[model samples]
Target: MTQPNLPLLKWAALFEGSSLLALIFIAMPLKYMAAISTVVKIIGPIHGFLFLSFVAIILFYLLTRKLPATTTLIGLVSAFIPFGSFVFKAKYLQ
Candidate 1:
């Protein structure tokens, strides 16, 4: 991969990781500890942006690299689930 593409991939991974942490640790706890819906109120927008970026990066990578159709599909679909990016990183991204 080129240097330019590398940053996008890395950012996508970071966004995904942060969102996962927010969902699991911050959001989940907020719901029970304070009765505040932090996930939907605060973390939602952040995760939404991350998910969008992940999709954009996937499209950009697909166009630039010779990625398999299955990989592309997996990357696209994985953005919907919490911690999906981590799974993608473990299973697909090297």
Candidate 2:
């Protein structure tokens, strides 16, 4: 299998970071401070899609790059926890 391109992985990481920031800083705050249900209603689906995309791209990277099984398992497991992608980025991506 071919190695995962670093550029694509970097882009995916950046996208995930920005989406996470939006969800945490903008959307969640809006829900609480402004009492706006739509904030969550809108951001929830957007965040979900981005999260799924991140996982899909990460899996693809693992397959193509032939990353270690333990690393892949870590990445998959991290997806379930809040702020877990940040941990994955810090530990694995860098």
Candidate 3:
């Protein structure tokens, strides 16, 4: 059986990436700098879930779609940086 490619790949990719950015840039900063842990308490779990989902999607694309190594690498790497997913989509996910 073949799994269909993720139809909303770009949207999911952007969302996952954005969530991570929000956690790192917005939530973490708010938690540490302002003595407010509420943001991390809320956003941390959400970001973790999104990150896992994103990686799962990337793995699906890699195993099922047989994406090129370079493309797969970009997709995997993009999850680490704040704006990397957008760049990855613009360059490779097209």
Q: TM-scores for all candidates?
A: 0.72, 0.74, 0.76
Put down candidate 2 lDDT per residue, 19-92, tens digits, no spaces: 77888899889989999879878878877887888788778867876566677778778776777777776667
Deviation from native of the Cα of residue 37 in model 2, angstroms = 2.0
Clashes of each: 0, 0, 0
- Candidate with more favorable, higher TM-score: 2 or 3: 3
Can you write out model 3's per-residue Cα lDDT over 1-94, one digit (the tens) per residue?
A: 2223445667778888788789989998998899999999999899888877887878777887667666777778887777787787676666
Q: What's model 3's lDDT at 17?
A: 75
Q: Rank order by TM-score, top first?
A: 3, 2, 1
Off by over 4 Å in 2: 1-5
lDDT value for candidate 3?
Answer: 0.76
- The numbered model that scores best in lDDT is 3
How large an RMSD does model 3 have? 4.5
Q: Which residue pairs does candidate 2 place in steric collision?
A: none
Candidate topping TM-score: 3
Worst 10 residues of 1 by lDDT: 1-10
Query: lDDT for each of the candidates?
Result: 0.74, 0.73, 0.76
- Ten-residue segment with the worst summed lDDT in candidate 2? 1-10
lDDT-wise, the better of 1 and 2 is 1
